[model samples]
Target: MPVADDIKSSWADEVELEGGALPPSTEVRENGFKIVTDYKYNEDEKKLKIVRTYKIEKRTVSKSIALRKTWKKFGESATDKPGPNPATTIASEDVYMQYVTSKEEDNKPEDESSIDKLKSLGDKSVVRCRTCGQEHWTTKCPWKDTVLIGGKLPDDKKGPAVTTGFTNAETGKPGGSKYVPPNMRDGAAKRTDSTNMARRDDTTAIRVSNLSESTTENDLEDLVKPFGPIQKLYLAKDKTTGACKGFAYIHFKFRNDAAKAIQALNGHGYDHLILNVDWSKPPTHSNQ
Candidate 1:
């Protein structure tokens, strides 16, 4: 059967209240009146469609529930971080450069301030701001860049000296680098700094505490030399008397080579005992 067109979101579900109105009041109650009940029916198809109809209404929630939801999704923004650490490499632009002119001539110009010599120069040299060093060219260096292990640290190196000795740049004292007189060489044929870059193959000097009374420097070198070059192999002796102190310093030409010796022969047979091997470096405060 055809019916009234629509329904709604929330139905009032109306019913006459059981106790509220005190029964049609005393004065009107004495009279009886005709009551009309509206009945709706199906004409042809025989089914009841609009049994009854009611309207719906809605209301807002109290304050407490709205506040509870505010806290769940946003406490603070996470898109931030602290600045870079001091130990980090810094990037920037401060550079200097120099060059040589007229190399075929016996005396190359000592200075590079003149542009007249720029075309005449045999080669160009770049002074890197990052490392504070000079190179024959700027091919590899970036103009402004984050510092790198590109050059030596000041503490790791010292001003070039006019002399040389065993006090070479490690442990007990100062370091040294090969240098040539400004008067002699055609170009700087960079001298290697034995102390600055401690290559993995650099020597690991060992001072064993309990070496056998019979173990000699030659004996230790004889064992390790097979694996790598044994540089300055010797056992430490008493300062005045000259008897073996039962300990030795076996310097390898390289650090990794020394490590290999410490690994392969550390627990090997040494006459009556095994060698006690350890790496010795000048002790720092924290290492203490």
Candidate 2:
């Protein structure tokens, strides 16, 4: 059976598809190998998981190309004759953080003040948990599962109501039907080219925040320029307040710089809320 390489697919959409209809169960028992045939469907994916993994040892055991190669790679790395295990060391992690403010230790100007340095390298810092009343970071918070505001659950929180379908002004063909929650309207991206070409620096976007309440579009632009060559800075605000909505966007001249900012701020929050850093602008052709 031809299996799909849909490992990175979403929870609901990662269905395995077989190319064609399969022949009825046939036992192709060779000299020393036993062959088993079955068709099983993975309920969650609503797809098939035709084959499973197992090991068999015989007087003269032989494995398929894929398994042999995988075994060779695993065995080579697991050997203690030399180097460290690359697979064991490389893993991605998610983290939560908080930044606190304090009065400057030096007589430097407040605006140009630097963060106060810790007294010693191994100094014990006591942190209060956000969810629980524990004396440790949020990761170790015992009451992480407890209710915070005693209101609606975060998962139960609902926002603006949405229409299931809308009249299609363009084709009169149900101009907009909501098959998915985010529906493509979340972005102005082209599907055909998105799977192929990438967006250029001029089209990249940045998530800018912590901007002063009096910061105007012009001031936001000037602040972001020093980070790197800036393509654009988009500042959205409440129409009545005239105050910054605690968020702004900046497009960088290069994608790397934008990625750097995202890495620096995402999860590592400032003020409190973890910034939502993402590519807001869609990809274009000329800039690439």
- Measured by TM-score, how close is model 2 to the native structure? 0.25
Expressed as tens digits, the lDDT of each residue in 1-288 for candidate 1 is: 234345422244332232223333111111333222223334663333222222232346677875663443323333222222223435568987777676766334444334336535654442433332444233434421222222344433433441232233233122222343442221111233322333322336644545677666666667777868766676877777665686776777767777777777667667777777766554354221
Query: Per-residue CA lDDT of candidate 2, range 135-238, in tens?
Result: 45666544343222222123222222211122231232322333433322212123323543334443467766654466678766655565577776779787
Candidate 2 displacement at residue 178 in angstroms: 30
What Cα-based lDDT does every candidate model obtain? Answer: 0.47, 0.49
Query: Least accurate stretch of 10 residues (summed lDDT) in model 2?
Result: 155-164
